[model samples]
Target: MTPKLELRGVAKAFGEKGSPTRVTAVRDLSFTVAAGELVAVVGPSGCGKSTILNMVSGLYGPSEGAVLIDGAEVKGPRSEVGFMLQKDLLLPWRTVIENVEFGLETRKLPKAERRRIARAELRRIRLEEFADSYPYQLSGGMRQRVALARTLAISPELVLLDEPFSALDAQTKLVLQKSFSRTLSESGLSCLLITHDLQEAVIMSDRVVVLSGRPGTVVDTFAVDLPHRDDPLARSTLPATQAYVKRLFDTLHIAEGAA
Candidate 1:
């Protein structure tokens, strides 16, 4: 089967045409996200992690190579991809269910069908009680879970998550991390997570891909082979998790003393 997402020697540069001050964010970046696999890409600051997401989402075009979804070149945003960013961006006026229905609305789905899907997703996240509540009424972690439910409501072939849980408190972050990881695994959806947190990458991803600094390129990729991949807490204590986190830090050139 064709990979759900593929980037072959992809490079992205941002600048005005014919401008001398061009900035190359990514170079020779090639990787594939297989069906039902969650791949996490980790790198240091200014390493163009988010730029890779933009190219894959079709919000930005590659300067040198191709960004393909199921062997088809990405010309523009397609319905098969979902993007969940740091901000929940939930409409304050809209209720939790209403916010999730926004995409289904654009798809011209009937009101009943949209509400059914929206509530179903909310229930999956154990937020059914808040279906009638507005975004402002929810807690930060709750809002993020709502956002995840919204992203999954459409059932996209792949979801690109850009630090989706970075803003939460430590306790909330861990709770949501476990919940989201379990949900993604059970949903059987492909995902690409761009994050700066090494432990977060290992806990949430099936394979972790490390990138070099500045003009980011693939430096290393590791298949997380923990016995219990779905349980973040259970997996973290194992020696394999420690090894992967150490390797990731080493690859990012982070000194052991500083880390």
Candidate 2:
């Protein structure tokens, strides 16, 4: 099967080649996220996780090797990819529905049609009731849901999430995680998530890619054989789930110490 995203011997460095102060953020990192699979990437802080994301998103180019989606090279940000950062970054001036349709509007979608699609997505996020409300009116989790709705409105093939729920309170984070799993499964949309929470990674992903600290590189990958539904109970109590999470914690600990 064709991978949704592929990185082959990718490397990235900052500053000019002759600069002795230059920093290498990632080196010879390679991985493949299969089509329709949700994969999680976890590592210590400043381990170049976001740098990898930036390269894949085309915000930055790889210093070596290549990035590919399916069989073609990812030369730039493809319309088929949607990115959601830690901050929802919704415009406070825009109403809920308006924010959701923001992408469509930028794409020059017709106003009426955009509204139609936006409303559907808002309903999917269970935020239809807040459609006319402004961003400030929604709670943080609700706002993130709105952000996700906006991302999905464009129907991108792959969603790149960078610690999307890290800022939320425990309760809100759990709620959104549940909703996200259902949404991903139902939509069959592929995702590459960068997160620090091992349990979250185990619960939400079909696989987890663990990276080493600075000059980050993929040190290990594990298939999450646990049940895929995003339920807290399954994540905490299921023997298989607990085992995988524990295994990953050990792996991360080893990776961090080695760095």
Candidate that would win on TM-score: 2
Q: Could you tell me the C-alpha RMSD of candidate 1 in Å?
A: 2.3
Model 2 is weakest, by summed lDDT over 10 consecutive residues, at: 227-236
Runs in model 1 deviating more than 4 A are 254-259
- Give the per-residue lDDT of model 2 (tens digit) for 126-228: 8899999999888999999999999999999999999999999999998899898888878999899999999988888999999999999999998887774
Candidate 2 deviant stretches above 4 angstroms: 230-233
Model 1 TM: 0.96
lDDT of 1 at 41: 95
How many angstroms is residue 101 displaced in model 1 relative to the true structure, after the best TM-score fit?
0.5
Q: Mind giving the per-residue lDDT tens digits that candidate 1 earns over 87-172?
A: 99898999999998877777878889999999999999999999999999999999999999888888898999999989999999
Assess the local accuracy of residue 187 in candidate 2 as a C-alpha lDDT between 0 and 100.
94
lDDT of 2 at 131: 98
Evaluate residue 137 in candidate 1 and report its C-alpha lDDT on the 0 to 100 scale: 91
